[model samples]
Target chain A: MAVQITTQEAVKKIRDKSSVMIGGFLGAAVPLKMIDEIATAGIKELTVISIGAGYRGGGVDIGKLVLNKQISKYVTSHVGTDPNLIKQIVNQEVELELSPMGTFVERIRAGGAGLGAVVTPVGMGTEVEEMAEKIIVDDKPYLLFKPIRADVAVIKAHRCDPLGNLQYKGMSNTSPVMATAADIVIVEVDEIVEVGAIACENIGTPGIFVDYIVKGHSYQERKNVYEELWIATNKL
Target chain B: MSRDYIAKRIAKEFRDGMYVNLGIGIPTESANYIPAGTEVFLQTENGGLMFGPKPERGESDPDLANAGAEPITMLPGGAVFDVATSFAMIRGGHIDMTVVGALEVDQAGSIASWKIPGKLLTGMGGAMDLLYGCKRVIVAMTHTDKHGNSKIRKRCTLPLTAAAVVDMIITDKAVFRVAEDGLYLEELAAAVTVAEIERLTEATIMNIGEWQESEMS
Candidate 1:
């Protein structure tokens, strides 16, 4: 029951200054073509919610948006890889919120599950404790992280069926939870097949949560991009 | 007092079939010292579990990597899961032990590793979560900072990762275990006298006479 759409059309669902949940860790399993389209469409003031910085180098995947200054705020666990993003944060050109990695993902999951809040002791006495409300249950203190839901979610999958069931080839990263926590879920996939092609056990993101499917860059294209990045960044 | 030596000492504590998480820095080197064919599973917070050794250059798979983004190979029975599930295993207390590096550790066994004031850092990836839920928390660090400041303090001057959560400390100088009695010296590194570590340590080093330098080499 998901509509197949072009990357351009899919990115059009995102509005300026809206929050977007982008799936991936350090550029792995990211919707490259969709992110590229969003950057090209000149979307401004987007609040990007991700786990970490985009790829090792500074001009691919999410890094492109940072380079373009497309992001007004970044809510992620870390941002050391991309120098441009760090510079923007240091210059106050971008507002940055850092969360503990596990807590960030749990908040998103809580949103998807329609939970009120996530209680955990991970940030009990750190800088993160200052930002969250603390609750004590049975003489134990726990930091309460509110659920996070985004206006739109752009995620990448290894493959998908016409019904929008997704399968991830490698690291799923933040895609599955983002798919559920967003008001609109747009998926970028390497291949599309019939509804029954992906087995039930293999389905990662079920069709119930997906709204649109976009054909992403081909394997060869993605490989070339990573290869070029590897050379340029000297990432062993 | 070497990193490898510290890692080897921590590796000895690993039992077969234990699910262990290793933090970046000195804890990552413990991978090299894990006993061969021990069936110990290494869980990287980035979503990899039971991965093989760090891959050689040019043979690295960028996608198959540790939390540190270093390329690694997957073992035969090893599998990769999503980040959510990875944290579930960590936060759910399914991980048996986690070894981490510390910037400061207080007498209360509190750990401060993530940040240093006025310095920019990437942020804590999964260190706090690991410490929050793992069955045992082992800190592997040098006894002193590069400037000769004792990392073992009576109280942490920096921020805290967790309070009274560290179960053990394995420094280059000695091994200390936290208990109701405070920081108890459990073992001393080879050729290191109790007086030598006492001078470098700011916290009260207790039960040194009861501790033995049994396994240190």
Candidate 2:
């Protein structure tokens, strides 16, 4: 059934201390509005798992979460620009599990596929091999990266049909696999059309993975009385 | 004669027809020193790029790139591919050499190349994958900052990029190959003496290779 809900309602399904797998490499397909809503909703002690965008890509990293203080733990491959989370982890205020970048992507792929584990040649001797379960094969030990299951997967889509079939531009697949892996997949698209309007070949993610679709809220139009002061001050 | 003594150390490793991946920051500078007429191919991690020397002004391909997300142009014979395939070249041990920037190198030759506690630098680009998966890795860097802290240290306190993947260390002072036992200092500039390096380093470094002055200007 198609669900019509606010971003806060979707985040409400995620309780405190839940191990939620988020989809994003950076801001590329990262659900920022949902993350912002979750941050504002007052949930705490949540663990987020995801990747990085080199510079200005993913907003899913700890910057916004640290600003909102919503994330308690992070199991991610890269948290590049967010210094607060790194400081918190260094200070032991937040728990962190840093994985290899490629392996982090594969971990999500394995999780959504329901595989118990997948073997890889990555992180054999490095710090990433120090997972919860470490095993050896052929006299060489391999760490067991368990399946990642999320309570909700918040994603960004370029376009969505009424039935929720999604389309994406090329090279925008940070959380594409996770889009189908989560229990509740909430997508925010720029535009929506009627069912059967989208070509089947272009429907990268099927409608079944989708539970709800919402157009993103636009804050571009809002003007403040102290807009210049606010803009300059906030720029800091 | 200059701080660019590090460049000559990296330049020595270049070979004809070598497929190389350059990391962000100073590692990218190695591209400027590749001997002319050498068929060295450059590969980036994000999306597409072709291998070549830098393109002419106003003729560079904007789509060509490295992991740093810089706008790059492909050469005449460059091939474009996806990150999945490019990383395959890295992970599958296809690339000949990979040069990355490092934050710290411990006595054990372990590297902590990513994440500074007080800095806003975001993300480790292809360094981990390239390091573990590459056949060999060269860390190109400034030996020490103006503050006089030896980046080659007892142990790294910052977050690690890869524990022990570096093959050679190229600093402005000298070029040292990291071995399982200890560091093997290969070459040094005339301005910076061996005594200065020994006094600076906290680890036990050995002189393994003969001294050779760099030929690059």
Candidate 3:
């Protein structure tokens, strides 16, 4: 079972220069509350591992950290959505490592499963192949990518039981893999229920993988964050 | 030609029961032109298989998005899985064809789509993987850039997504099939002339004069 904690306490687990895995696809299933707490704490020079850039541009979701200059390095599939991050990357202020979205997900999964490496034919003749080791299996060539694990993982879900069983609504993008690939896993959920509230069949992430659970901002509150951002940018 | 006309032409290449992957940009529009009663399964690299067209405004689900993060809907027998399984279908060569947009394509069919020097790019998402893994690679793009420069180059000056991998190029003005010799002009857009295509193109387009828009149903 996981203990219910405040977002501040959850943020404390992440220190400066720590490598963290964030679960989301453009803010859909990201841990915005914990991320906000970290940004407020002014932690600097962190390494962020994510699937894509934050949604709708700067000062929103993970883009806030990019705007704050808290992240020194980012490993992601794409950064087109955030112009701030793109400017930083262009200026060489922040180091960026690019990966295929599918390979990035599989590398994290390999980390959790205690696997040595993953071999795939996805980037055989591209620059991605140059970054990896090539091995031949049964006379077939494959690019071998190393496993990736983080010091902490912050994830989001629709519901979490007191035992930390997570149930996701729309789709579980990177949460399931990040949950198992980190040393400490913190989950932010919309609602918390009693044990067995989330049936075993419906649980996307089991309680055994969670270290801490936190109640995130309400739906309306979270909505207001982006709403205000849009108004401020005159996009609405 | 309009974007929809390009999509409709590309849609005709899809065979029933073919598992297809559509890349971002102009290739995403082909889903709207799929022939009715065809069982083509649209495989998205972001973990969606057999999805329908983009949803109506206000009906879009943030969670159910395509590779471009635009809201979409799932069709019958559609299943959503993690990224690993999605790429397994891709990298394992299970997909029949994939449609992608290119920044430039050389005469040898090498594609350069992800990056251009001196420009800030969003980085390659899954274009390289699709180019390397799919059985057939169909490139869909406008014939020229905004500056009116030819995109069909003798050699790609930009970083390549993949080399010698493209099977066919379908632009707004023409269709060229790659062969052992070089690019062969197989089809032309409606009312487009061979001389006009030659003037606008940087690569040497061989006119085999076989297929045309009128010959296509």
Q: How far is each candidate from the true structure, as Cα RMSD in Å?
A: 2.9, 6.5, 3.4
Sorted on lDDT, best first, the list reads 1, 3, 2
Model 2, position B28, has a per-residue lDDT of 71
Order the candidates by DockQ, highest first.
1, 3, 2
Residue B54 lDDT in candidate 3? 63
| Residue lDDT tens for model 2, A54-148 | 12322333366665666777776666646566667667777776666666666677777778885666666555556646777998766787766
For A1-236, candidate 3 gives per-residue lDDT tens digits of: 89999998889999999999998777555788888898898888989998888875656789989989999999888888899999999989899988777788888999999999988877666677887899999999988989999999999887899888998766577888899999999999878988877789989889999999999976556545534543454433
Tens digits of lDDT, candidate 3, B1-217: 4788889889988899999998876677887788898879998887788898765544555456666555668898988766667777887789999999988998998999888777848877777777878999999989999999999999998888888899999988988898867899887788887767878889977653443343452
Model 3, residue A94: C-alpha shift (Å):
0.8
Q: Assign candidate 2 its CAPRI class.
A: incorrect
**How many residue pairs clash in all the candidates, one count each?**
0, 9, 0
Looking at model 3 chain A, report the run of 10 residues with the lowest lDDT sum.
Answer: A227-236
Go through the candidates in order and give each one's C-alpha lDDT: 0.85, 0.65, 0.82
Candidate 3 pairs with clashing backbones = none
Error of 3 at B39 (Å): 3.5
Fnat by candidate, in order: 0.54, 0.17, 0.42
- Largest DockQ belongs to which candidate? 1
Off by over 4 Å in 3: A218-236, B56-58, B206-217
Supply the TM-score for candidate 3.
Answer: 0.90
